[model samples]
Target: MGKPDAEGHGPAEGLPGLPPEWGRVVVPDDASALAVEATQIRRELRRAGSLPGGHQALGLPLVVLLVAVLTTLAGLLAVTWPRANRGADRPTPAPWSPPATLVGRALPALDLVDADDAPVPLRGLLPAMIILLDGCPCPDRVGDALAAAPSGVSVVTVTGGRTPSARPTIERQARALADPAGGLRSFLGQPARPGAATALLVDRAGLVTRVLPELGTSDTYRNDLSVLAG
Candidate 1:
């Protein structure tokens, strides 16, 4: 053993299990205080499940996936729920049925004769308007309709037997046809009446779209003629 130095330090010696460089380290009695505080902080973090390397961190991915799934479910419910609710409250529309009128019925077969008392073939000569000049006054009604008649439509004047006595000029102007058998009147359902001037409107489809019982003006059949022309 050597004598003590002037600072009262003993001779240097190796620790039992420490390395040789440990002798160069400066350790005080308070050094262990910092180490104890660090150990206490680690223990508290473990209890609170906040440790980055503990079991809580290991389950972090599963928690994030669960939150993402919940968010997706919420978005889906928001989009489709309103449409389903609206459809449930909407009313269903009723089916439509055509009215019971001559507008929907086809024209009946006609029996016509020309001026020479010869049978006339009515094939391919439509969309035409038949003017019933049987008891109708002279040529005014037939002439007005013939003048106002649209292009593509043929005007045929039918009489009980003879040419109208009042105005033979305009009466002969139209395609004069005689229906002595009363077949045209019967098919039209027109009764015998004075000044009974009825006009039957026939389309290219041979469908009777209108039946004017007592025609007096040009505008009456003008609108219907335009549509038929189209």
Candidate 2:
């Protein structure tokens, strides 16, 4: 036995066969203090990878952030994938042609005949002004158009709906014709209205230059007729 130190405890003298590097071990008397020491040792061993069955526990905030990131990525893919694929895979459609209006275009293949059942040669009669009379005889307007026509311009009035037995006499190098089938109105796409007249000015090249929908004045006819004659 060794002599007592100042703390009134004897120095360690047992286990002399142990190596010099082995130090004295201490044990606490209280059970609670022993449990605390055991818990600290286990935690250190787990962190150092010396303990088995140890895994890191992710915090609630970290798990929520990961889930949000994945959801955002999925949403981005859903929104953009179809648009990219459509631009790459689908062929664009061709532009549509405008509706058939005679202005700046050649006349369609038409077979027109006069009231006497004689075939009216419209193609042959180029550089002409055609006045379409709707729902009335419109003799005064027809007369004004015939008189105002320039020397080379031919005035042709086409009346729709009926074939009267007493037709106006074709005078002043103008021809009074009738379209009982409403074929002329359909060809020109003119809407039917009471006392509404439409004027079409055709050039020498068989291309319609101007289309006046509501023919108001004879001066309109005169100006377009002069242009047609020129």
Candidate 3:
């Protein structure tokens, strides 16, 4: 209702959302840009199956979870493949020390008598080798081994500490021993587990050094005694 100002404007002309701040100014290039932008927005909306709305940011986290799950699957596959392909590749260790229960800590002092009533000191001998055997046919597996041992070494055989079942006869090999079981316990420091044989080698200083069982014989005992005697 008011007349135009000197700058060719009215009160409503400069108001936002009604028209341009001054008056309608036409730019053909601006119209073209708007049309192109509208086309791009419509294409994006159609590709997404809906117009962009709430939860649009939730898609990023879903994509991330899928990638993490794929990575975990790959790691599991790698671990399982080697196990599936395992062949007879296990290793067997060489002869070594026996368990602590078999070979005790320090060698303890032992007392024994010969065919005659004489006391012998176990300490300060050049080298002492003890063999435990069940005297039946008294196969004496280690007798020759001990006799032929080095000059300075002493070879003593301890019976499993049992009185022979029958009377002494070369043929009745089972009859010559008494108290064999006890000797095994006192000398070898072993509780004499049945069907088991244990051997001990004490050095010149009487130090409890090497122990050999029927299975896991001491490397040092075999090597040192063999080297000294052999």
Q: Each prediction's Cα lDDT score?
A: 0.62, 0.61, 0.45
lDDT score for residue 224 of model 2: 78
Per-residue CA lDDT of candidate 1, range 85-163, in tens?
A: 4478778865432233767567666657876777765434578787787766547777787777778887777788634
Ranking by TM-score: 1, 2, 3
TM-score of each: 0.50, 0.50, 0.38
lDDT tens readout by residue for model 3, 130-173: 65555222234454444345666666555533333232323222
Candidate 1: stretches off by over 4 Å:
1-100, 162-172
Ranking by lDDT: 1, 2, 3
Cα miss at 56, model 2 (Å)?
A: 44
The model with the greater lDDT, 2 or 3, is 2
Task: List, residue by residue over 60-126, the lDDT tens digit for candidate 2.
Answer: 4344434443443443343334333335767787543223467887765455566667766666777
Q: How accurate is candidate 1 locally (lDDT)?
A: 0.62
Clashes of each: 0, 0, 12
The number of residue pairs in model 1 that clash at the backbone is 0
Runs in model 2 deviating more than 4 A are 1-101, 161-173
